[model samples]
Target: MSSQKEKTSPFMAKAIEAALSAKSITSPNPWVGALLEHQGQIINVSSTKKYGAAHAEAQTLQGKHLPEGTLYTTLEPCVAFEGKRTEPCTQIIIKSGIKKVVIGIEDPDPRVKGRGIIQLREAGIEVQIGDGADEITRLLRPYIKHRQTGLPYVIAKFAASIDGKIATKTGASQWITGEKARDTAHHQRAWVDGILIGSGTAISDDPSLTARPKNLSPEQFTQPLRIVLDGSGKLPVNSKILQPTGTIIATSPKSEKNWQDSLTEQGAQIIICEPSQNGSGINLEQLLQVLGSRSILSLWVEGGSQILGSFFSQNLIDELWAFIAPIIIGGDGLSAISTTGTSTLAEVPHLREIVIEKLEQDFLIRGFTGNWAP
Candidate 1:
């Protein structure tokens, strides 16, 4: 039989994969996975589903006749929750007679920060922590930041030609990446609390901004909140964003009341925000604060250059995901970001812990920002 620590590596990978399987519906709650082993054989494998559904541990215990020997979880089992929609996961594990618990990472919720582990240990069950700590921490970065800072974790998604152009001189940027990369971008929409874009993208693209994929059914799809940062309240009345229930149109405090009233009548939440320090756009930090107050845990930004540039100039981006197509568009094409305040080589921004993957004809690059580019 493998020791608990020895099984951590493989178990962690399995658990992460399980977590990803539920990427579409797990929001406001961090994705979790659990594996149960009896003797030397695996008994159960599960991951969290929709919010308020059975959590990872509870799902693993379901239909198992309460049989368990050891449990491995990507996150600590939740000790308690405020609502009546679900029971405490810690109590469920204890009642199942699980002899041991191996946790990949601690729960970041201030309410359950290590409380679950403490509860299990006090029940005379052996508990271990720090298995696959680095990977698990990285996985839960958004959840951690949300709990600690009361802000949505920002992920900026960009797609550009091999030469770093996002669009042509005329701003025509359709079908830059292949089908596979586009599919992945749609998946990104399914995982986030909301999608944000500037009025420029919204007006020019007139995008529906919904998570509608060719292969998925409408009934099974989840649509993120469609957020448009319209400084001048210039959003078209017939725009598709206004058709969604969670549509938010943020404009500067100086916006006209008639425009506000008109949008409100069209099922849009009108948010008045302070203008940016540069006086040309809405304050990025203030907008994020508004989003955090609404309990939006993660925000995905799909841009048309200016929006991406604003976030970059303010140093507000937390993670970045970019898809680079195989072909170049030249300097005559539009750059992915403009006027980012990088004058010399020393000031360019650098990404830390970068990971790259080839997706069909495009390359996917993911990383965290270390600092603003010099």
Candidate 2:
């Protein structure tokens, strides 16, 4: 018998590539891709177009008549359900005369779960599951986490020197990493559903926080939502983040009404969150839930120490990406994470599945926290 990799890896890779083509544009919906094959030859490959548009399976099998063959998808075909915008992909496949269906993983949404697989099998179609499961799971992690926990997958990203300093005592932080790493950072900013920073970073850096990947036109990339954690609403009215249309300022009720109103006039939406139990800032968990309710599947946190500390202390961070440069700023400089609430080495949080990649003069250290994967 042929091994599973020999049978499904190539097709699944193609499907995943197709899915990534639309990943940035599909939010609140998983980026899915499908490939239709006849005999040993491939017929067509398609991916999700946009939010609320036709899914990958439907896009692949619709309006096409082909010989009985196999269908490979990065995600389980969705079944018909209430509130779904389009026809169920299972029905479409059954009518398309496809003989076999190979799926990457089951849909995590409660509405679909394993129902799509059952629907296919009941129609007398051969079904194969778990091909390319690991890769597909990583690709759909944000969507899976959102559906499973009603919380966006949180990723904390920062750049620091070899000695673990983010900036000097004077707060100058420009050009910490090389050009290649900075380019990669911009690409990451474009990939997530939202990009977040604390008010301190906003006031000190005065960053626009826009994703401008090198050589890519604005039309080619969708700008992720800009979010700021400002419990006191102390963000300056002239801050660049406030100029964006999709900016959200998470503040506490104690914030000044005039400051909130001024930011509102500048196209920023103010979300009032309860103060943390320690009375230090707004509740991070509550803010995450609010983002999840708004269909934010992934959140990228670019910090200025205090915000990173809050997230790490609350154990709200799922993944971390640290870009380490070759230079050292010594102990007097600001650290990447202000506090981790650990008094001993044993108490420090550990990362799993660590991956390190060299980018010019910088090294990117990435890992998942707790039981989180990918």
The TM-score that candidate 1 achieves is 0.92
Off by over 4 Å in 1: 1-7, 63-68, 214-221, 371-374
Give the true-structure RMSD of model 2.
2.7
The local lDDT score (0 to 100) that residue 181 gets in candidate 2 is 93
Alpha-carbon local distance difference test for all models = 0.82, 0.88
lDDT by residue (tens digit), candidate 1, 270-306: 8889999889879889999999988788899998789
Candidate 2: tens digits of C-alpha lDDT, residues 1-374:
11234234898889989998788888888999999888778788999987888999988887778747789998889998988898889999999888899998889999999999999999999999888787777778899999988999999999999998898988889979999999989988888999999999999998999898887666556799999999987899888887756599999998999999999988999999999888988999999999999999999999989999999888899999999999989968989998845779997778987999999989999988964543
Question: Model 2 lDDT vs. the true structure?
Answer: 0.88
At residue 225, candidate 1 shows an lDDT of 88
TM-score of each: 0.92, 0.95
Clash pairs for candidate 1: 346-374, 347-373, 347-374, 348-373, 348-374, 349-373
